[model samples]
Target: MTDNALAYRRSHAFRTAVTDIGGHQRFTRAYRPQTNGKAERFNRTLAEEWAYAQPFTNSHERTAALPGFLHNYNHHRAHSALNGQPPITRLNNFAGH
Candidate 1:
C-alpha cells in the first residue's frame, strides 16, 4: 500500500497518492548550508533531537534510543509548518477527509 514511494525516486509529487517534494541540490561554496536547506534542517533536527539529545555509552544504547526518538518525533514534537501540530496529525486529518 505504498504511494509515490514506488520503487522509484522523484517520480512526481502528488501524481499518485503522495509527492515527496524534496529541495534541489547543487554545488555551493563552503559555509552555504542554505543550498540544501530542507535536508540541512532535517539533519539538524536529527542531531539536536536524537543523536545529541542524551549521552550514550555505546552504539547499542544509541540504537535502542532511536525507536523512542522516532516515535516522539512523529507523534509528539510539534512543527511550526503545521500550526504547531505533529506531522501524524496532518496525515490523520487528511485521511479522515
Candidate 2:
C-alpha cells in the first residue's frame, strides 16, 4: 500500500518488491480522509492498546512487545467492524465457506 510519503515514491526497491509480488501499490487520494480511515483507526488502536499502554525503560523492550500485541489483536480481540469477531476468526470463517 502507498501513502502520501515522499520516501515511498523515491524508493526503487519498494516499487520493485511490490511489483515482483504482483501487488500494485495503491495510493489514497489527497484530501480524502475516509479512504484511509480504517488504517488510521487501526494505528490509533495499536498505540492506545499496546504501545502506550505501559511504561518502558527502552525502545527495545517496547518493540519486543509488538509481536505479542499483534497476535492478540489478530487472534483474540474482537472488532465491532467485523461483527464482533477477531480478524483470524473472520479469516477462518471465510476459508471454511
Candidate 3:
C-alpha cells in the first residue's frame, strides 16, 4: 500500500510490476493516518537501516545491497511488535528454516 502519490497512480511500470508479482496495489485513504502507519513505519525503518545505513558510490551499489538488508531484517533484527523476535520467528513451517 502507498499514499496517494501521483507517480504510483501514473506509472505503468509500477502497475505492471505489481500485477506480475500477483499483488494488488492499494492506496491509503486521505485523513486516515492509521491506515498508513505500518507502511510509513516500514519506510522509515528501511531508510534508517538500509538506504542510509552506509555510503554508496552509486545507485547500483545501493540497489545491490537491498536483498542482503531485507534478509537480515527478516531473519535477524528484533522487532518490538513481534515481542522482540525476528520476523522469521513468526513464520510457521517456513521452508529450509
Q: Count of backbone clashes for each model?
A: 2, 0, 0
Give the least accurate 10-residue stretch of model 2, judged by summed lDDT: 88-97
Each prediction's Cα lDDT score?
Answer: 0.64, 0.80, 0.88
Question: What lDDT tens digits, residue by residue, belong to model 3 across residues 6-86?
Answer: 998899999999899677999998889987897799899999989999999999999999889988888988899999888
Top candidate when judged by lDDT against the true structure: 3
lDDT of 2 by residue, 19-66 (tens): 995768777677788867766787789889988999989999998998
* Candidate 3: 10-residue stretch with minimal lDDT: 88-97
Every model's TM-score:
0.57, 0.68, 0.72
RMSD of 1: 9.7
Residue lDDT tens for model 1, 1-97 = 1222234244453334333323342333446556456556777888998888899999899889988887788788889988988777877455521
